[model samples]
Target: MKQRLLLATLICLPLSVLAQDSGTQSVDNEALTVYGRANVSLQSSDEGDGSYSDLESNSSRFGLKGKGQLKDQLEVFYQIEFGIDLADFDEGDDAVSNRNQVVGLRGSFGEVMLGRYDTFLKDSQGSVDAFTDYEADLKSLFRGENRPDNTVTYYSPSFNHFKVGGTFIASGDETGDDGISVGIIYGDKKLKKTPFYAALAIDRDVADYDIEQVTVATKLGATIVGAALQQFERTDGLYNSDGYLLSASHPVKQWVFKAQYQAVKYDSDKDASISVGADYFFNADTRVYAWYTGRECDIQLYQSRGCGASNGVEQDFLAVGIRHDFSW
Candidate 1:
């Protein structure tokens, strides 16, 4: 009950402030925007056993974002985003989870944000993952994909198509080791105005692993191709792993076709996955999509990482869904 109240307060407080200020200021310089997306799918899944049908909610979320002028060339910004599960309305904390809730300042020096958010290494991936938030998300085969609390991040202003950023994760009193992440990126992640994008990032002691990753994507005509390679080492020096991803997508009018391949190897254990999907757009804000992904995993990987199945088992998923995004 207390958690619910706290969350409600956090959400409503900003709106109340916006209401009081909007009447006297320009909406463009000081305004609050409510935005979110709903993404749900029906899936036929097999986890190395029998097949079953289920409905899945793919990280659907809603939030409020606002920015206010603070001075001559400075601004204060904030966002309160939360994840909602639409497939099953279970009670308790699982019903709603935090996403990128943060408060920050931006100016000529760039931006500095505080609170819970994705690390620099994680953000460096950008939109290269063709199957993000789905069964084939890069998090399934790679380390350093972290969104941790008690974080402080800084992003430098773009200089000649290049930018750099860093994140510091405070371990609090419970843990003595602090985590750090850093990244350098070039070009635009959306590829809307740029022909190519590239990023190199590193994480140390975040989520109990050290990781180095490189990601690149290029737009050729109407097609986009992306790839990523990563190396992960356990902070305790007990294990080391490597992974790579290749993905491509092509759009024809209102239809898009996508495919991806990814694999990870650790010692003698290996896991690999393949996925194919397509999307049909009703408009810019809505789309319907379907995808199929299959994976083969080694037992050793299951024991050590709690991923995949024992004895080189295979798992598969086929899903179709609709997504609608809205902003106000």
Candidate 2:
């Protein structure tokens, strides 16, 4: 707790100093943005044992971020984000979780950040995971999805739609060795103005595993198709696995249809999951959606234990939800 508090102070102190020094300038010279998303769902889940219903909070979060211009074309920026659990608010510490909180600088040399944030290997997936934050999130099958503290990261500006990034994670007296994550990305993940997106990333000793991942997505007429391949190896060499993900989505007017499939293979043990869903947009900021996910595994693969099942059992989930996003 003390360490976290100190890290927060360190991140905020420089920003405060910069704000005061820039006081002489117009307020418009600096922008403070408040952004958030509220996503909740009602779910009917079955884990090969029994079926139950509950409300779930799907990675809902709020954050504040801003940037202040400095001399030599450099700028200072910071962000503090926290996840909120709307379904069970009284869960104590679990109710509120830390997310990508960081202080950084950007200029001609590109950008550098310090604090707690997602590693480059994790960010390389982009928006390919159509079922992100859901029961079938890709993090369940892949090993590189990590957000660690005591870290420094760097990104180079895009050149011809290509950019490179890396993260250095400090062990902080916990281990004698540190970790690193690096990636090279091309094109936009949103596929807005870009026709395709691709990324290759690798992680060493992050989250107890070494990983190599490649992700690609492209628009085919009105539909978007995406895929990801990953290789995971434990640092201790006790385990190794390979996985792949395939996803697609299509939009018709205000409604969008989506589907995803993921599988992992390891030493004769296999895990797989499938999800299909649709979203109806009230506008760009609000939407209602429904999805069904089914997962089966030969061994425990994630914290949720492969759809909340034990070993060889199959688990299933059906969810309907609403999401609202706001920014200022």
Give me candidate 1's TM-score against the actual structure. Answer: 0.89
Residue 305's lDDT within candidate 1 is 32
User: What TM-score would each prediction reach against the true structure?
Assistant: 0.89, 0.89
Clashes of each: 0, 0
Give the poorly placed runs of model 2, Cα more than 4 Å off. Answer: 1-29, 90-92, 174-176, 300-309
Q: Write the per-residue lDDT of candidate 1 for residues 78-107, one digit (tens) a residue.
A: 999999998887556486889999998776
For every candidate in turn, the CA RMSD to the true structure comes to 7.4, 5.4
| Residue 61 local lDDT, model 1 | 96
lDDT of each candidate versus the true structure: 0.84, 0.85
Off by over 4 Å in 1: 1-29, 90-93, 299-306, 309-311
Provide the lDDT at 133 for model 1.
88
